[model samples]
Target: MAPLRLSLACWDYDRVKAIEDGRVRPEGIELTFLNLRVEETFFRQLRYKEFDISELSLSSYVLTLNDPEPPFIALPVFPSRMFRHQSIYVNLKAGIHSPSDLAGRRVGTPEFQMTAPVWQRGILEDEYGLNYDSPQYFTGNVEPSTTERTEKVPLQLAETVKIQPIPKGKCLAQMLADGEIDALESATAPSTFGTHPDVGRLFPNAKEVEQDYFKRTGIFPIMHVIAVKRSVLRENPWVARSLTKAFASSLEYAYEAIHARGALRYILPWMQFHVEETQAALCSEGNDKWWQDGLTPQNIRTLDKFLEYSFKQGLAKKKWEVKELFAPGSLDAFVL
Candidate 1:
């Protein structure tokens, strides 16, 4: 039997680099890897099913569950995860000194339904006492460029929460910098803040805040999940396990390379110390696993919380179960 050839689209992260460089390959499959920006990948994959397998936004993926026939079925492999406390950017002139000040203020975001903003909003509401429904929202591109980006899925916002796009020529960063919006939450750093001194992060000690949040919540928020097209899964069911095994191997390979004490592979001078610190913060006491994959207890707990947040924020019509999110075969490890 000939091996199946499939297209996979995702960012070129260190964990997936082995698979991209052909050091690791999915069993019985030939992958054509497309290293693309996540937004483009998500847009194409979600809108047109552009690739056989691709990185998907968890929030967007949850929204698809409400569809009668979702175009994609996910694996438990999470390719991207980030602490979103650092994602909040606020204008110094907005009088928003604390999270509580965000209540009744205008806020801007690239997209309300995007995973980072959803996580930030949920965190603000749960941890900091900001009312989720109080702020008026403006959604637009984060960059200063004139190009506009729309939400991939329809939102189900509360009647009291108003959201609109910025004007055709403007962007969220500019809106935030000019004090047109009090704050902005985005996955990508807004360009204006680098040039404009007035724009600053909401949490100055973001690392400490994020570490504290993780210690309290036990959730290092997941941003993206890998998904295979439903038609491909229906035809080649074994591909799910194959891809899972390949990605896990790739992640292990990345860990070994990162932990090698000889020299720094990354640009940062204290990279090893940072890596060790991260491990201490995120990993369980006995295990060396920092960036874990699959639907383990911790991962499932995080996913369930994210789903609840999505539902509460009106991104998902209903709270989805973890079992329904992944292909059945992927829920267990395969043996040779």
Candidate 2:
């Protein structure tokens, strides 16, 4: 087969290799992975057909559904490491004691429509039974300073939370430290950010979320999914199936290897983030409550539920059924 050219916007050098090793077609299929963030630049490339595949949030994808262009294959749901666990953090000295107290508080977030606020609010409502009272969003200004640039996405949940545009260049951490915002919807691992002395926790919602998910459903909600252009899949269906298998197999391999004592030394080299720290966070903060290795029917259903709620919240314009979104043969009966 000819070499498959692909573009993975997210920079997960280690994780991609793990997928390539496990899932690429014909064993030794050449895949060119480009390191780029999926921003307007990516959309521009898609219009020019400069790439084959890219990662996209479901909400963002929905906004472009009206275009005459082909749609991307929503790869098997990979529960976001962040949303799989909800970590409700607040300023320690704010005197806020519980989720209930967060009701009128000024909360900061990068995006409202994105997963950050959706899942964060879910935690507050579903678990703590508290209303965060629509978060205050920070839409980094146009030509925002470096700081503002980092937080530019518009708020999807502003109706649920207040929206505030912090000037560019100001560290969100500093805002948290100075009590400008009581909390931040850190959609990634908490360790992704430096340990903040001011940002203490009332309830480590990340751990609580996993527990709550397991109690309600058999799996944790799926987060980010590797998206493929639907036209590309129509031309080559096997590629989609192969990619799904590869992703699941890679994750399974990682899980098994980590359990086989002494493998950490070998696995450490492939990790982009600190291996020990990520591993520790995985162990302490990891949500295996419903993880049976990789994606499962329950996982897909969770994603559907999330999308449904997102659409109602206006984060997404339409509801994409699981069968319609995922590639055929992508979801196997048994989790690896």
Candidate 3:
């Protein structure tokens, strides 16, 4: 077989796990890795067909699905992985404890159309009737494809809620600490915020929103997905299973490695600033960690929800039967 040609575009978070940890090595697969910011560059790449497979936001999937050309499909690589919390956090001094307190305060998130922000804002609007910022009025990147535009709503409400975008991961925490920004996207849950001294705790009312939102929608806003192009699947059908197997193996390796006595020592440096714990808590249960048990039907359902949302939100150009997103039995392969 000639060298299999493929490229993967992923977020900074997954890149560290796949590359630095030696999990998704490119040596045997003829894979070229692409690290991209999930921003305008993301849309530009899709428009130009620069990547064979790339990670995309659930919201982006929804927006792009509406487009007529360069038809793409989303595969369920890791679904509803709790990739991060994307919560609402305020500075201790801000005197804010609930979503309602956000009335006139500026809130910072990773992006304008990011899953976290959309979900958070949706909860505020749909439930609490809190009006979020207007498309142009907010501080974050307002990409038409990824974010929704609400028109004719009270401009006062939109202007009152400020949306500031922060860089991914640690930068999000650092900005909260330095007071460069107030509140966080809260992508990671408790254990993550506990790692930072400046962040006191998630907004007191966040749980209600999460629970109520999940109850009504049957899905949470996803942070990111390991998406692949439909064309790639045609050229390398077996690659999907190979990746599924490799990812399963990697998860097993990460789990055993973290649980093993001395393994924590090796993983510490690799996950240091990226994750908060010392060598002792490398594998402790919390935050957006990978699953050792591998993917499942529920995972697929979660991915499907995002794709469905993409279709409803006009992210995907056309609707796809779930099978179109995966190999014939990739779903079954992961389950067994």
Best by TM-score: 1
- The best candidate by lDDT is 1
The Cα error of candidate 3 at residue 151, in Å, is 17
Which stretches of model 1 miss by more than 4 angstroms? 334-336
lDDT for 28 in candidate 2 is 26
Predicted candidate 2 versus true structure: per-residue lDDT over 137-166, tens digit per residue: 553322224433442223344355456667
Instruction: Kindly report which residue pairs in candidate 1 clash with one another.
Output: none
The RMSD of every model to the true structure, in order and in angstroms, is 1.3, 5.8, 8.6
Better of 1 and 2 by lDDT: 1
Show where candidate 2 strays beyond 4 Å: 1-4, 13-15, 21-29, 35-50, 62-70, 77-80, 83-86, 139-147, 150-161, 188-197, 204-209, 266-295, 329-336
Superior by lDDT: candidate 1 or candidate 3: 1
Q: 1-336 in candidate 1: lDDT tens per residue? A: 999999999999999999999999989999999999998999888888889999999989888888888888899999999999998999998888899998888999888899998898888999988877778899988876656789998777788778899889888888888888999989988887778988999999999999999988899899999999889989989899999999999998899888887887887888788888988998887987878888778898899989888988877878888888999877774344
lDDT by residue for model 3 over 1-336, one digit each (tens)? Answer: 566767766654532355434565543466666666665345655556578767665555545544554345554554333422235666676666655666665565544555655555655655565555422212332211245323111111233334333332335455555555556554444332566566665445545545455555444345555566667777766666665555555455554545555445454555444343322222334534433222344444555655553443332455665565554634554655
lDDT values of the candidates?
0.89, 0.55, 0.51
Kindly give the number of clashing pairs for every candidate: 0, 27, 19
Q: Model 1 residue 216 lDDT?
A: 88
Model 3, residue 156: distance off in Å is 21
